[model samples]
Target: MNNLSKTTLIDQLTVEVYQNRNILGQEAAKAVVLKMKELLSNKNRIRMIFAAAPSQNEFLETLTKAEGIDWSRVTAFHMDEYIGLPASASQRFGRFLKERLFDTVKPGVVHFIDSENSIEEECKRYADLLSEQPIDMVCLGIGENGHIAFNDPPVADFQDPSIIKSVELDLVCRQQQVNDGCFTDLKSVPTQALTLTIPTLVAANYLFCIVPGTNKSEALKHTLSGPITTDCPASILRQHGHCTLYADDDSFELVANG
Candidate 1:
């Protein structure tokens, strides 16, 4: 927990601003590791969902090297994946997690969405795996558009009845992939993706949302100060009692004086 600069609450969500992205990732990993240890102390195993993007690089790196936790007792899942990316594409969420986390920690169980299969069947398959257990934790990030997972504003539903569903990606959401260096251009990014619903994400017992960078400043501001609406999807984090947002000074700049 180094370089913590500010802390506040918006509704039930706790916001922690660190001096930089490195500190933000370090502190977030430290807190999540402690939570994992606590949950494992009582349960035979714990389930966790992860978000894959450059925003998670430092956090995943730190978490993989954290000590004192039995990774064998942890089960992992990713929040979303593109429906059309080739299996070898590095931009694919599943590949991103494997290279960053699953391969490093070797979790007891890692459920991945196989988009190569029929889209409908793949969604149903992944949904069944998610429903088999209660998710104990989720490590996620907000999009530049303030969306969570792939739940872009145009398709986000706070009261969604589905555990997972495929949605057409909006222009801003697709362009963000290019902005993040995941795709060479917006045309190369997948137009559709399967994402865990907003309800499914908040259903987790604890949520750690790691968002950083000046690129995220405007979205972060809307998420923290705007009304709880799908217009700024991540704003719903405020309603989750156990969710915490980890942001760095750069990302918090716009909201610092609010």
Candidate 2:
């Protein structure tokens, strides 16, 4: 087996694949906070999109503890949410942000997709809102299947125009949620989700993606070494001007042992 390690890509895009998952998560969170501070020093306001998943637990915890960030001037948004789920549901991204980042920092604004509302109407409304702003940064994670947000391989579109859309969940993605303990079984997970499109996520000035654990190894390889295609939605990050990836030992196997 190959040992995992970190690699520095061109520009400021560094990929750190650590042996310790907790260390990897903390480092990623710290890097994001530092980047946010640097951007805020120049920009009047900052907008951010966050991904909610068990993989992000450690990173989010570290971020919520980061000081020196003016949360009041920052507007927050989430990557995606399960359609038809109530905001109060434990599985809801809205509730996750409220408990994890929002209540702690109280950002200037929080734009959460109303998954409980009609999916089509909510998608159009959210797309309009995102279209009006240039997001400063986005924190995301890759699914075990290499999906970004809810843009599963089958539904992902690199040329998508709208910022938000409803997508059917892929089998691998659903299984991932179960494996991560987000749901008791496959049937408990939603069949569809409201996800931010590829163009919208890439529109951000910076993208900080965190991928940890052994389960993510294959997906990480595809994201880092594969062609930029919807087959691996995260591969699109390669085209962004300022995109960085953080991975732990298991997830970094390909890059590290190369």
Candidate 3:
């Protein structure tokens, strides 16, 4: 594996913040979509993983609106979902993807975790579905606590063999859901979730991590400067072969000033 501790690795993966968050989101989306298009042009098929949250709103909008890409050749998968939430639920990650991207384009396949089903069954089912294909690209966002997907500080593991598992929600992660308008209050959000594991995320050929806003500044710093431990789940991206971080002025402040 490549050494993430090397100065060149940090310099290579770190992207300077943009003047505005929206602009940063759009640029990152454009770059990833273009790369996806290039890969699809050569391979004829592409599998992609998407992360859903208020933070990814601009990025998804820009990707869905972009022209010339053959959406029909793309297969889509998402990062995580709240266990026990129906697909029709407003807070379901599947619904977010359908409303935000799938409905707008003719994608070949969309495999969504059925959070309403038995947690273990849902995890096994999604893992089986994903096991068949190698992900061409993954678009994700870092949580305020530096969590990736639902791999909160307590449960994240970079070397775990399990591709997907049920996990309890952290207090900070739940609060963030409410703050993002996914729910009116903490009680409205599910306490448990099914998320793709860190190992699965790192297996992707390319990773595009988009983080914006002042709220993410501290987490961004931890992700970039902190040790690669489960306590800082997003930091595992540093070990991936091809990973890019896109942040806005506020989110990149720590890295920039350092």
Local distance difference test, each candidate? 0.94, 0.85, 0.85
Assess every candidate by TM-score: 0.98, 0.93, 0.93
* Model 1: how far residue 96 lies from native, Å: 0.4
Q: What tens digits encode model 1's per-residue C-alpha lDDT throughout 1-258?
A: 458899999999999999999989989999999999999999999999999999999999999999999999998999999998889988889999999989989999999988888988988998999999889999999999999999999999999999999999999999989999888987899999999999999999999999989999999999999999999999999999999999999999999967
lDDT of 1: 0.94
Give per-residue CA lDDT, model 3, range 197-243, as digits (tens): 99998899999998988889889888888787788899888877688
In candidate 2, the residue pairs with backbone N, CA or C atoms under 3 Å apart (3 or more residues apart, or in different chains) clash, namely 18-249
Instruction: Please list the Cα RMSD from the true structure of every candidate, rounded to 1 decimal place.
Output: 0.8, 2.8, 4.2
For 1-258, candidate 2 gives per-residue lDDT tens digits of 133355667333557666677887788888899998998999888889999998888899898899999988898999999986666689998788788878988898898889888877898888877777788899999998889889999998889977898889999999998999889999999998999988888889899998998899899888888777788888888777788888887788765565
Question: Candidate 2 — which residues are off by over 4 angstroms?
Answer: 1-4, 10-13
